[model samples]
Target chain A: MSDPSSLLGALRVVLVGTSHPGNIGGVARAMKNMGLKDLRLVAPRAQFPHPEAEFRASGATDILNDVVVNDTLEEALADRTLVAGTSARSRHLPWPLLNPRELAGRLQDELRQPEHRIALVFGREDRGLSNEELQLCHLHVHIPTNPEFSSLNLAAAVQVLSYEVRMALVEQAETASRKEDQPFGTEWDAPLATSESLERFFEHLEKTLVDIEFHDPNNPRKSLSRLRRLYLRARPDSNEINMLRGILTSTQKAAGTKK
Target chain B: MSDPSSLLGALRVVLVGTSHPGNIGGVARAMKNMGLKDLRLVAPRAQFPHPEAEFRASGATDILNDVVVNDTLEEALADRTLVAGTSARSRHLPWPLLNPRELAGRLQDELRQPEHRIALVFGREDRGLSNEELQLCHLHVHIPTNPEFSSLNLAAAVQVLSYEVRMALVEQAETASRKEDQPFGTEWDAPLATSESLERFFEHLEKTLVDIEFHDPNNPRKSLSRLRRLYLRARPDSNEINMLRGILTSTQKAAGTKK
Candidate 1:
């Protein structure tokens, strides 16, 4: 299993036009509490070196010290392949609205790929991400708060999003290396199969089912496809793959004998 | 439905050991945004007159003006019957862990009963509710956040929990007065029957269910009792009592016919 620390390193948190230094400090503390260390401040109104920020940051000053201060959102997100903006209100622009759970699943898939760098961007405290700013990201994440009153603070937004990212990474890592006899150290040479690999397996399994007439080809409503999507969303590991494939093979043989 | 404004008055937010004045201000804005005005601060570390707090509060200074700062926890909770503590971590003590959804359900019940004050307490940002402090609460409400990283900011915690309370109240109020031609005003007394009357109906209904063998006599696993407790907790209106009783009769008849 990949260590949470390594996954945290790959994850970057961007805060834009943060009005309060204490919020920056609070965000840093929130990030650290969830094993996330990378924090990038985008033109914060208050100076980061202020005593209030330090006081609020408490023990998380290390994260605050290492934060990358940038003047623009584009600069903050230049390296990130996957960028998610958090908003309580729906925008006029067309962006996929993913609840926290859906966003977590998508993040798990994105993080497994070696080439993906995930960035979670939060806007100012007063008014959240502008439509223009939200357009910069691949996905829009809405924390399923009360629709009557859904004003989440900057640090709290960071905390919720960061916690989801950490959870997905941890669950993925645990599922990947659960079979190892010893405690697997943080570093591992072998890459666990990616989502693409699993997708390929599902495609093969579906095609085989179609060939065996288990799935109706002409009038297919994509039940097999939906099942594949569900498993892909789950991000199954090697042990799970073996067990599932074994079950499929045995079931296929049993059907063949009956025929 | 009950007037949204009257229900707003019943929401009493109690913040414990609030280290930052700005957070208190921000919380005021959050509460005001959701039509909630009552805020009770319990032993703030910093002085309330801090400029940072007022600056962050924006236009919610009225709420700040009406803020009641208490010297002790007992003082803060003196009038409240239903107390819910927000905690991210499990406490050493054996208080039941309830997520926001479950707590919201409980809060809705409490809101129905007149002369009962409800308080939602949020702890300091650094170390959440201490074991001793958590034990003071009848129920510990967890937000059901990402398990890997579940750090919720003090004001944000207030916002989410209060928002849930507001929504639950609105929903219950609406379902209660769906047939009413005139909107119920914020005043405690009205033409409709109060929550106390509704409680009596529930008592009668439970007894009727028991007499008819709808509820198991030997192994009555507290499910019906829990329902009674829930309605008692919610304190229903006259209309809500009538609607629920109607549902109970229909369900009883359906079960009888199937048997």
Candidate 2:
């Protein structure tokens, strides 16, 4: 599998009908802090690239400069495989409602497919995504705020959700590294030997053993079968299998001298 | 354990030498959204009741209204039983440094005593808390952010930490019936090969290798043992081992025909 940043980079943060330009700037800063670069605005109410936004962005103006403006949320999420909408209330929707942590876990699973892209959609400041917008998303994410005061600042909401995504990626990388320590991970230098290459190796191996007089044709034994099992268990990489084949060639040459 | 709101209400948010009045309002909003009400300021540069702070506070003006101002950090955390300071860097300090999530877990354990009062202090906007001030706290809490772009907005930092606190409290309430689930180690399509199947494959393999003149009978070079090691590492499932045995049978037939 690829690095966690690869997954983070594939995530698209879409803001729909954001009323305040300052919140846009704050979202940029929050996204940059968590290593998320993709930012899309769908029909923003205020003028972007405004001084207030740049000031709020602090030093993440680069994110603002590169922001993509889409006329509709559908265009922003057209290429995305998974779309998750942020909601302050989970009870109102009959759809799947996940807390931020659960959302992160789901995203990690979805990103296992290399080409998969994810979009985390946030709605307007005063009101969240409309029913139509919510229906477009596969799942709804709730930040689990105080019920009485659940109105999270637009940027603050982005910060919390993005932070969870980053944490999830970090944890995934850590788990992969831990599996490497256990000697079972695919993070090795070379790819495993394919079935075709392994078949060729076995053919060459059997021929050489017969030529070298190590294996008797008239009186067959179980040695060849045992050796086949051993090779299969070892799961030799392509390079290792080539090296074994070379050794078989040398053995064949020596046996030819006797003939 | 006490109710989450009770612990949240008992917790104090102290801002030290904060220069921006707007950020103060942002902090108040973040705190209120997470069910934290106690707000204290230590020698703030901007006016406490500034219009900008009120504007940014949104509807969280109640939290800003009850904010306590103190002359020094000491006065601000005088009554608090536990103190956790926010830091961007966790390396330099010799004191206990915990990530936001870990800090929340520790705080949950510490807050078990109903009489306990905890203080989460934020330093100046530009320089953060002075080393001397950090020394006064029990531990440092670092929000894990992208190392390349680690300048978190003041309010965003508060929002993230407060979000963690709220999540920790909510999770604590749900822990009684919660089951531990691993995020990785995806389920496999097939069960692993049984030892019996593996042994049968091994018997077929050894005979095939000998027949092909690859393995020497009179003067064996420990090839069987080496191959054993390699195959063991592969950990092929039953289907894979069966396919391997079939390959061995084909190799044996080809070698026999050549002889």
Candidate 3:
């Protein structure tokens, strides 16, 4: 029911505490390259309309001219449903990390929902995403540069992500156009399983397993997580998940256990 | 023989007929971001070390400082063995156009050889690589852009390509390092059929078919090509090919009586 081009409109490129105006200009041009328009700067240190930025932006002044600068990151991300932070370094605590390509695909999937707003947050050039800023984001995206010299230019990182988004949109458009004559893909018969449905199914499965003594609730090692990862990777559609849930219910009933 | 990081040394980012110094600066920043050092300018309309460029480069002054200026494209590319020209628009004559990722892989494959120098040439901001300039380069690299507004900022284009190269290098390094302990993959036991061996098998199979009057060579449509494609897709290993050849020999001997 949605077109990939509209996904661009749903995306917001947010810069937090950007020190250089030229980098901002560079990002604007990068966003324009991918047909992305929304630009939100969270308290930029440099002055806006700095002739240097305009001079550097080249033909993408349209993006810079319409740029939105907020006093804080929360204000910039107030309307965003999904926020992804860019980081080159690993965190002390493990967080779900996505490369640019995966982030683009996830963004496209999220945009399929009604009125979903996506924010791709980039942090300061020197220190990268702060722990507070990182925690606020739903996912962290790493561009994957050389380990020896992994200092990717901020604008270049933006360009890489913008390119990935453009590619994802183009792929979706092509797939849609190609499917015009006849519907394809095995999953076309069933809508993709919703997040809430998957969560419910996991809860039911866990309860049933614990009741049946198949899983130890107290000492539940990585088995549940492994299963979750497997299911997520398989990406079962609604019908498939429903069938599996039914099987789980039946299995629990046969075992004379309550879920 | 070479690591991905060394590839940067062998690569030269060449900009032709650049009108703005800021773009040159932007290119330098992009190059430096990806660990690329060599910057060659061919007949720039703007003066060298323009303050605007310095202002825009942020901290990549080392790249801008060591820039090589030439009056002609040929002079800039004289030392390079592999040259890839960047173009945004399609041309009258179809050239071997590769997207940034494919170009990066091809560059990596080419760089496997000793003393190989590669050049990534970008044309002016307004009109991309001229027909004459294109003819000189071995391949054309096109960054996939949004069709609605495909005007990619020159430096952004540089950033995208540079990022791809860096990613490709990192991926190669990872794959190499991962394979160090306990080698994997199903094909490790047997070497895959070489192109020459596959071609010979195809020729033999075709001759045997004609000998048995199964395929009329004179009126053959796409049968030969189709069979070639099928075998190629299968990607038979040495043992598989040998077994298939033995089966074909037996089948031919049995079909002689019918013929």
Model 3: per-residue Cα lDDT over A210-251, one tens digit each = 654443233354445434533543444566566556545644
Between the candidate structures 1 and 2, which one is better when assessed by lDDT?
Answer: 2
* Global lDDT of each candidate: 0.64, 0.77, 0.71
Candidate 1 chain A: minimum summed lDDT over ten consecutive residues — where? Answer: A181-190
TM-score for candidate 3 (chain B):
0.66
Please tell me which predicted candidate would have the highest lDDT against the true structure: 2
lDDT of 1 by residue, A116-174 (tens): 99888888888988888999989898864434446666766676666666656666766
Per-residue lDDT tens digits for candidate 2, residues B48-74, read 789999999998999998998999999
Give the lowest summed-lDDT range of ten residues in model 3 chain A: A178-187
Candidate 1, clashing residue pairs? B109-B233, B109-B234, B110-B233
Instruction: Tell me which of candidates 1 and 3 scores higher on lDDT.
Output: 3
DockQ of 1: 0.04
List runs of model 2 lying over 4 Å from the truth: A1-6, A90-93, A177-259, B1-3, B177-259
lDDT of 1 by residue, B7-102 (tens): 666778888888888789878877775567789888888788678789767677888999999987667776565667887654432334565655
Q: Considering summed lDDT, which 10 consecutive residues are worst modelled in model 2 chain B? A: B181-190
Residue range with the least summed lDDT across 10 consecutive positions in model 3 chain B: B180-189
